[model samples]
Target chain A: MQFGIFSVSDITRDPVSGETPSEAERIDAIVQIAEKAEEVGLDVFAIGEHHNPPFFSSSPTTLLSHIAAKTKKLTVSTATTLITTNDPVRIAEEYAMLQHLAKGRMDLMLGRGNTAPVYPWFGADIRQSLPLALENYNLLHRLWREDVVDWEGKFRTPLQGFTSTPRPLDDLPPFVWHGSIRTPEIAEQAAYYGDGFFANNIFWPKEHYMRLIKFYRQRYAHYGHGTEKQAIVGLGGQAYIAKRSQDALNEFRPYFNEAPVYGHGPRMEDFMEQTPLSVGSPQEVIDKTLTFREHFGDYQRQMFLMDHAGLPLKTVLNQLDLLGEEVVPVLRKEIEARQDPETAKPPTHAKRLKDKYGDGPARQPKPNANRGDNVTGGSPYQDSE
Target chain B: MGQNFQLVVVSAGTSDPSSTRLLADRVAGRVTTLAGKKAQTVGTSVVELRELASEIANALVSNHIGPKLQKAIATLQRADAIVASTPVYKAGASGLFTSFFQILDNDLLIAKPVVLAATAGTARHALVVDDQMRGLFAYLRTVVVPTSLFASTEDWQDNGLNKRIDRAALELVALMTSGFEKSVRDESWGSYQHEYGSAGGTELSIDLDSDLMKLAAGGSAGQKSAG
Candidate 1:
């Protein structure tokens, strides 16, 4: 099981001060949140990309690449890579490069994105989104595995001969998860390719995510990915935890009520009861999150939307300390103890690359001794030829 | 026998008969042999500082790279495969190479199969390929081949280097010919229109007499629309 935090990059008003963070303050806060995620023994921290107002991350790679140098052991990924809008080639190369820089600790969650204007800005129509997502991802998948690609499609121009470089480290590309909120089409896309399906279960109820997960598992098996249980799965969660349930609710309530995504929509208590959002003690969050496996089946990665809602940097950091110290260790132990090796396999970078390549371990290298001495032979000139 | 693939080698070494270019040629030769009659090769040597100096000294400031450069760029843009070889300088790719990279058409290398090769003085410099070079390519949105063939003088003297190159060539051929063929069903159906989509006209049409008022007032008129 992987434990991580994700942010939507919203600049929120400080609950205590009633003052909103400047864009610069919000950007710096995102960096601090990511650093804290690492300090707390978390395995990953993902940042969402949104180009519109109130959101800061226009370039996720620039942010992730910076994070790659700042921390070790924490895999950085995009909450969404906007498969429908960005060119598949750029995505393939950028992440492949990050995989090398991060030493294989990179993965991406592809989505059609939440904003509609982004489509037209990228010269794509919203109506062709599903087809664009499907076609673009198909091209991206090949780009990572194949050395040369000759692709001709409705969305992008044909390639007579094309090769993306520099190569991936260890001959393996990063793993990918197709993220979906309500669209069965995205789930079907993930299933068709036998890739991981991330059901962002935070917005919907368990029953809704269950159907989506079930559909993916069945179709995953249909595509011969693996047995239903073996299909790679990850879930999304939103939480705000404290040592006591009452304190947690009191602190998070005002923030939640004002949150642009869910604020003013449902009462905090009703929202918590209906969705995967846990606003209470650490134990309560852990327990509520653990029961999720029963509804969606054994999952590979568990991510929480903690840094959203304009929580101050200090509070978010404190929440991470509790989640990592009190929550993740327990989840890891429980998930591991319950896992059946015969049916359950933790997702690994190598496994995903093999799945994508449609082959066994990348071709092995052979040595040649005929060109010996010249290998070490110098410039053959010492200022006198 | 029916498969046709194009090989583009991007070399960034300054010296004529440079080791990096030699290594690039060897890789290209192996591909040519592997693809038999169906393979063609396009090679570009981007001695960056020199190109930049010339561009800076002349009216060529338009970032409008020439036909020869465009032909080399097309190798990356339109080729089925690429073998990019460069000499390591200060523990990273040459500045010349990076500057040329800055001018490449956006997203031209996406999904294209690429083999990375580098020639450095010592194995200690291997990090140059893994860290800096690979890092730069990722920003450009290209899929780098996973298995790289790195050559150091010591390995060459011990006769261990060429063997790796051979293996790289063979494996690269298999990956490109099989996987790329399957991924791309048609070779010439104009899929690249989106990538090479009109980059606005590069033609320099400077009409000083046309309308100075419209040019100067254009700024104010735009603000008025916003008002």
Candidate 2:
């Protein structure tokens, strides 16, 4: 039952007053939102990476590293760590360094970014993004998990031998959740590795997200991970909460309607009806969110998109206070009642390390190794003839 | 502590097979074994700055040789104990290695121990171990081992050079397990502080390099803000 909020970081005109925050203000607002999330007992604070206008978070590591210094327990992460465009080697080393700085309270949701021009800007062809994502991630996985890799791949120059460093703190790499709104290939990739599948359940309906989550759950089992129900799942939601349902909707609709991302597209009311946006009271949000289990099952992480839609920082913090005080407690209790401990496990650093390295001390060599001095035999990295 | 450690083998040469990383591995491997620990080794093979004439136009303008080299900087920061092996280019260390250090947060290496080793064709540049590296380590405030191995390429494959590796390994294990005890701790009972109310030497920048470290060192000059 991990719960938190994410920001797409758009600076939009305050529709009523015609005021808008500068890019600096929006960035500061994001930091403030993350701190407030921790103050209210949230588990994670994920910031989306977009190398486009209106969005200020071009360098996620710099921001997340700053956030890492501010908070202690909250898992700082990227809402979308562009798996397609950015070099996986940089992603591996930067995130690994952040993981150390945060003391293992870091994870990332990988996505082939939402922007198109960013691909060429970073010297990547958008048409080859799928293959790029697959290949780069394959190298990234080895970089984090293995020490030395002699790799020759399509995306990058040949590495005779290379290792991405700071080696994760406590020898545990941060857990990864492959996030996708429409791509079933991303869902399959997540399931194939038994990693978490995060449906940006904000834009789409429950039926579409349900199918993806269900597919992931089935294929997760197909990969010999566990039962379909035991598959790790997370969902995204857009929410705005206040003391009363009408007041919350009234304050939020202007921001939603005027947002640069979805502003000109759909009416706020129609968007709410069609998607997971809950612009209402804290109690209504809790009730609506509790019903998510009916469609997506007992998921692990739940993130709200409250800071987006150009809402002021003060209003966002107020919404968080209401949700933290009224909403999360009820959801936590209700979810716990329905959860089976064996199946309803949250994906944690400990769980991930155990699943990958088995139930042994972090330092111990692989189970096959008998000699303590031999570094070559037990390694799954290099093949021994 | 789990006692499980990984080895980072940094080499500056572009030769066929890197002897610098190999020698670094030998030292790191033996020490890790002695500590009853498992190790994963990483090698960083560098492209010398002098050979970048084709890419110099881009490098001069941007000061970054693409993302691959950028990732190299990140890798160095993550290592627990680093073994820095470089070829003695000209009369000093390679210009590429020196330039790389300029990009790093120099203060981050405050108390981290590093085993320095160098390789060259001729033995004339041996003073780099003392003149350049030791001076750089002093500025960075890293604990430089008194024993540093320097070898000409002729004796690079010799067994006697490995004895220095064994000794460095043992000393590193001792240092790692026992931790560095500063001289200030040993002479804490000086007369002026006991007789009169002298404040003594107190500054925040004396300790480690992180923001929190600076705060801890800053004494009352530091302010902790609420999130």
Candidate 3:
């Protein structure tokens, strides 16, 4: 299983310190945090994209590229890139460019973006978001593979023989994960394309994810992707660990009690008891996380939400130490021992390229110096003709 | 679908022996007797909101439905009829009562027969049941009886309160006997709005042939004129 941490990139006031870090500091801190994630032996470091205030990651590829450049072994990805508002052409271009820059050490998750105003501001409709997501993803799926694409969709202007440049690193599309908490249609989309389905199982109970994950797996097999066991799955979790359980709870209480998403909503203990949140010692966290597999079955990836809700950089780094040092190792060993061999591993750049080309060289599309015409085969490129 | 029907009472009264519970029980009792007279059996179950106040609040704020709240939801989902009574506070239904209903899935109570009752200290808030609470049940799409039961201290001593209880009970029994909920649920359920996993997580039906489903499978959206 792949272990990682994902952040919503909210820059909030520290409840205990009574001070909010500036965007610059938070930006710098996220880079440091991503570096620490790699240092602490974690595999992936993903960040959310938000076009609103108190959120700094409006440009996920830029931030992720910087992090990818700074780290060697870690995979950088998006918690969710807006599939509704963002033009698929731009997503295809920008993320492919990021793929090339990062040496194929990246993937992306697509979401409809629940924030309502973001739709109209980006010339899209919230009412049309689900269909928009489906249509955009369809175009996006073609863009990465079909070099010369003639495409027309409702949300965007039609394209005639348009090729998204910076052809995917090793000519393989960065693996896509359809992230959804509730929508079964998104799960079906993920299954239909044999893409990964990531359940943001943070706020809601496990039963909600269990239902959707089952559907995704069933549909995955129905679509001839793989067996139900082979369908890729990912789950989101929250953890605050210390050497002692009480200290972990006490330290995390203020942050939990003041968080924008959950503060004043439910007591931290109740949330931990009912949801996937584990605020305790490493052993306690490990025990609680183990139940996830029992409920959702053996899945591919587990991403803990570690860096948001106004946690100081130092505390976050320290939390990573416990996670990387104490928590993840035990989880890895135990989960591996119990996992079904038929379950697919989470997608990575190297594995995907290998899957495409067994032992041979991967595709390297060489363009024909912007000939500005698709007359020479579908693609106006050296490789196509 | 059976001769024996389940009647679930959801009482948001806080006291040891609350008048809200008393009012709902009066309605339930009459419904049981009335059903018996019609050669049917009614089993009553109570969901004391006083016991689930924290759970409902937690669910509202945190979206985590507690075990007790889950059980209550399951009980209500199985209910053929419901007697939902609340104590009026500050000229409105109690927050516990409102929050509990607000947290329930919109489709859970669709077409279910219900009797609305309220016990307030003053008769000034008699409109709390008809004026405020009825709108809530309407939103849930529940078939609430036309008679709204309001029990003030004075009304408890008056025979008029018993008359209202009998009317609401008789209305609920008639709706249940007619099997209106069964027909709407069986025949026209899809016409009602529902989230994918709403209705206490039992609404698991997925239409793979839906227009959205086709779009999810790489079909065009705006080009084809979306539903």
Candidate 4:
């Protein structure tokens, strides 16, 4: 399993400290946190993309590329890159560019953004968001795999002979994960494409995602990708830990009471019991997280949301330390021992590269020099006709 | 058909034996007696919404369904008929009552029989049951009886309240015994608005032929919108 931490990039006020960090301060803190994650031996660091106030991450590629530059082994990715509002053409070009920059230390998860008003801001309709997401992702899929693409879709203008530049770092697109809270169509999309389906298992009850995941696995097999066991799956979780369970509860109580997503609604104990949220010692968190594989079957990735809800940077770093030191290693072993052998390996660029080409040279797209335009070319590169 | 017809009473009254529950109990009692006259037995269960107050609040806010709330939902799911009564507060039905209904799955009560009842301190909020609660049950696609029972402080000792309760109970018995909910489930369930895991978690089948599923399969969305 790939153990990682994902941040929603909320600039929240620390309830105890009574201070909200500035955007710049939060940005700096995220970088330090990512570096600390690598130092502590976590496998991945992902950030969420939000365009509205109190959220700092609008451009995920820029931030991820910087993190990728800073850390060697720790994979940098997005909790979700918006598929609804963002133009698929831009997503294709920019993420492929990030793939090349990071030397394939990056991948992305796609979500129809939760904010509704963001649709109108980008000249899209919220009512048609589902179809928009489906259509846009269809176009994005083609843009990544096909070099010379002739595409027309409902959401964007027609493209004749368009080539997304940088060509995806060794002729392989980054592995994609479709993250959804309650949309089965998104799961079907992921299954149809043989991509990963990530359930943001933080806010809602497990039953909510259980049905969707089961449907995804069935559809994946129906689509001839593999058996249900081989389909890639990931889950999102939240945790706050201390040596003693009481301290963990006492310290997180104030933040839990006022969280932006689900605070002021349910007691911390109730939320933890119903949802996948685990708050307590390392053993407690581990026990709760292990139940995920049993509920959804063997999965590839497990990501925790630890930095949001106005948590201080120092606290986030310390939590990462406990996670890296006391939690993830044990989880890695436990999951590996318990997982079915047919379970697909957690996705990475090198593994994908090896899968694409074995003991053979990967594609290097050196363009045929300076064709006047893409319109009159048989192929963009010398490798194809 | 296998056993006594299941009737559930959902009371959102604050007190243990508040007037709202009293009104619901009276209706349920009459329904039991009426069913017995037809040579059929009735099994009744109570779900006092006050007991699920925090669970309702939690479900409303965080989408977290507690253990007690899940058991209540299971009861309502298996109910052949329901008597839903609420206490009126500030010219509206109690928040506890409305909040509980708001969190239920849209298709959970489809075609089920229900008798709507309300209790208040005055006659001014009498319309709250018919005007407000009826709209909610209608939106859920339930078959609510015609006679809405509203018992204020003065109506308790009056003979007129008993007449309405009897009339409402008869309507409920007719709807329930007619096999309406079963026919809807067996024949026309697909016509209603539902999704996977709806209807108290019994609706788990996905329609793969849907327009959205076609879109998910790389089919363009234009044909769907255009049609």
True contacts kept of 4: 0.55
**Candidates' chain A TM-scores:** 0.90, 0.91, 0.98, 0.98
lDDT value for model 1 = 0.70
For each candidate, give its TM-score against the true structure: 0.58, 0.59, 0.97, 0.97
Q: lDDT order of candidates, best first? A: 3, 4, 1, 2
Clashing pairs in 2: A166-B78, B204-B217, B204-B218
C-alpha displacement of A26 in model 2, angstroms? 2.0
> For model 3, what is the C-alpha lDDT against the true structure?
0.92
How good is the docking of model 1, by CAPRI class?
A: incorrect
Clashing pairs in 4: none
Q: Between 1 and 4, whose lDDT is larger?
A: 4
Residue B11, model 3: lDDT of 96
Each predicted complex: what DockQ? 0.01, 0.01, 0.65, 0.55
Clashes of 4: 0
Which stretches of candidate 3 lie above 4 Å from their native place? A372-378, B222-227
Alpha-carbon deviation at A124 in model 3, angstroms: 1.2
DockQ of 2: 0.01
Candidate 3 residue A194 Cα shift, in angstroms, is: 1.0
- Point out the worst 10-residue segment of candidate 2 chain B by lDDT: B195-204
Query: lDDT by residue for model 1 over B1-227, one digit each (tens)?
Result: 26556667777767777888778788878777766644533333332234343332211333333334545554455566777887777777776667666666545565566667788888888767777777767765556766676777776575567776777777667667665533542553234333112111111122222232122111111211221
lDDT over C-alpha atoms for residue A311 of model 1: 83
